[model samples]
Target: MSTKEMFLTKLKRVIRTGFFNFWRNGTVSLASVLVMMVTLSVIGLISFSGAILDTSLVELKNKIDINVTFVPGAAEADILNIKQRLESLPEVFLVTYATREETLAAFKERHANDPSILAALDELGENPLGAVLNIKARDPSQYASVAEFLESGNTLSSGGITIIDRINYFQNKTAIDKLSALINAADRLGFALTVFLAVISMIIAFNTIRLTIYIAKDEISVMRLVGASTAYIQGPFVVVGVIYGVVAGVLTLLLFLPITYWLSKVTENFLIGFNIFSYYLHNFLEIAFTIILSGVLIGALSSILAIRKYLKV
Candidate 1:
């Protein structure tokens, strides 16, 4: 037979043998599949959760912005000019100007029930707040340059305008930096856990498959005695591994979808601008391929090791 035909014939035989073997050892095969499914499910859960957490942190960071309060006498024209200048900066992504009246109105609206504060504000006869420029930076570190620009009374705040009286750089900067650091640390820790769990799952699946093969040692030896070539002897085990892999992969996908959907709902605002379902659906093929590949590799390696050690082949 030509090489291609021979390979095709061997592949057919492998499939036939694998099905027969599974039927003969139905209970063990089912148990092996169940174990593999559960293991892969755990792996998928860990991966999905880690992704959600990372995305949430990024969304949180993007929501944070720096507030620059202008002096009481700063001109509206000057403030508008500063807004334009800040917007032109490479680091600044967005700049919003809020008038003093708007600021006080927002504060009162937020704290409407505080009668004491309202009475005190009324006694003052005028709003104590100032026009504030809200700045969002493309890069977190770029806030320092934005702060310098505001504080130095440069072009934007120049012409005796003193648009920015004080910049609350330390408060906003510290909060953003601390949040970023915490998120980074949490992500690293999650990654480590994922890796560790993956290894453990791989080992467990491998051993389970190996144990299954051990129980079939006599039959494998009988096939070898019947003048079967090594290829013929090993073919069915490899085919069985492939079957396990495909089943485990499908199970993992099924378990991941609903769980991700539920989590997305629970963390709606926290994970704004992110769609977990869309992401998984888009990457489903890649994730499925990885899952199947891992299962097959573990199954094949375990089968080979078991047959070699127990069958003394």
Candidate 2:
């Protein structure tokens, strides 16, 4: 046979043998698929939980910002200059500048329902509000660095006068610190858990493959005795492993559909407006790719290693 035809013929034979082997060891194959399903499900749930945590944390982060209010008599040019300096900071996400007039207007609007406050403001006859710069950091952890930059006496305008009256970061200090710590902890814990689960799954699947290969040791010995090449001997088992992974991945996806749908409302309520089902549907392609690739690698690696000792025959 020509090389191409020989390769094609071997490929077909390997696939056919793989199917036969799968059905021949039907109960063991089923157990392997079920074990892989549990692994894939855990990975999928981790993705969902991570999404919910990230969304909720972002919402909370958005609500926290540093409010820098200049003194009432501070020059507008100086305030604008301070705003420019803050904008130059790499850690800063946004620096929203509100003129003194806009600040006064906003204050009045907020207290519109309170006649006493409006009357008190009118009695003053002068705008007590200062031009404000609302600073948002790119990350919760970066807030401290920005605060340090501010406190480093960079608030000095062209003149020797200190324009900044107060920064509200100290007020939100505790909350920001806690949030930063929580985000870091979540990231570390998520990575560790992913590694832990994947390793455990591979170990279980690897042992299961070993047991199946052990059952076929006699057949492998006969093939080895008949001068069968290593690749030829290993090809069918590899194909069978691939089949197991693909089936398990498909079943995992189907299984998640109903489970996510059932818990959609519960997740929306408890996970701070993030619906697990919605996330699953939206990120289906990415999730499927990850789970399927993981399954394939795990099964194929297990089979390749499992048959190593038997190949000596």
Cα-based lDDT for every prediction: 0.78, 0.86
Model 1 local distance difference test score: 0.78
Model 1, residue 256: distance off in Å is 3.3
**Weakest ten-residue segment in model 1 by summed lDDT:** 153-162
Writing each residue's lDDT as its tens digit, candidate 1 over 190-263 gives 87888788788778888888888777788788987888877788778877876777777777678878877776
Query: For each candidate, what TM-score against the reference?
Result: 0.88, 0.75
Candidate 2 lDDT, 85-165, residue by residue in tens:
889889999999999999999999999999999999989999998989999988877888998888887888778878888
Off by over 4 Å in 1: 2-4, 153-163, 261-264, 269-279
Best by lDDT: 2
Which residue pairs show backbone clashes in model 2?
A: none
